[model samples]
Target: MDALEARVHRQLERMRELADRMAAVRVRETSADGVVTAVVDGNGALVDLELSDGVAELSPTDFEQTLVSTAASAARRAFAERGALVTGFNEEAAEDG
Candidate 1:
């Protein structure tokens, strides 16, 4: 292949790799008491949630706060991970070009 075509192919491959990496990204966080766990994908969408038996012992307000805080933590982690991955990819791509 020509040099230009090879470069284009490499760029396309890098883009595909980035997409795969982002798709595989997930962040999980549990509450301090370990009563609630939240899982979020790279897009910050809640993919799973777990509630331990101990959660039932919490007051209504505490239960709500735990769930909300846990989910927010997970989402924040996912966003941070996604940002780092994208930033690294961009740096690599810039170096390559």
Candidate 2:
């Protein structure tokens, strides 16, 4: 293969690896009061939701807020993790190039 073709192939392979790694990432977050927990994937999709006994004592509005905030936190964390992975890949590619 030509040098340019080989370089393109290598970059495609690296991108595939990055996609796989990102898909495998999950971030878990809990509310400050420990009443709510949420899990989100690298794409910021909710994967799981959990509540503790303390949640039962919260008012309806508080409970709703807790769930929203907890899930938001988890989603943020997941995206941050995704960003880190992309950053690492870019740094490595830059160094290699």
Candidate 3:
């Protein structure tokens, strides 16, 4: 490989490192009315979940599933947004370097 290519690759590696460092963060999310809450990692893994007592009182067969799904989706969305920020930070850093 040539010098320029090698340098670019190094820069990209740095960018990836930055992304990885920021990626393992845990994020918490909740439903619109704060009834359901979920914790997710930067990889969008659902690490923890919590339901309000009020929600438990409702007692619908599918309600729990639906709330969990909703919370997961919200966490995923938050992760994606954070990932985008990381990507942008990498790009800017690369440019500056």
For candidate 2, lDDT tens digit of each residue in 5-97?
A: 999998999999999999999999999999998999998888888889998899999999999988998888888889999999999899879
After superposing candidate 2 on the true structure, give the runs of residues whose Cα lies further than 4 Å from its correct spot.
Answer: none
Best by TM-score, which number? 1
What's the alpha carbon RMSD for model 2? 1.5
Q: Estimate each model's TM-score.
A: 0.95, 0.87, 0.60
lDDT of 3 by residue, 4-96 (tens): 898888778876877776776677777766667888777777878787776866557556766777667867776787777777876877686
On a 0 to 100 scale, what is the lDDT of residue 3 in model 3? Answer: 83
Residue-level lDDT of model 1, residues 1-97, one tens digit each, is 6998998999899899999999999999999999999999999899999999998799999999999999999999999998998999899989987
Worst 10 residues of 2 by lDDT: 72-81
What's the residue-level lDDT of 56 in candidate 1? 73
Give the least accurate 10-residue stretch of model 3, judged by summed lDDT: 57-66
Better model by lDDT, 1 or 2?
A: 1
User: lDDT: which is higher, 2 or 3?
Assistant: 2
lDDT values, one for every candidate: 0.93, 0.92, 0.74
**Each candidate structure's count of clashing pairs:** 0, 0, 0
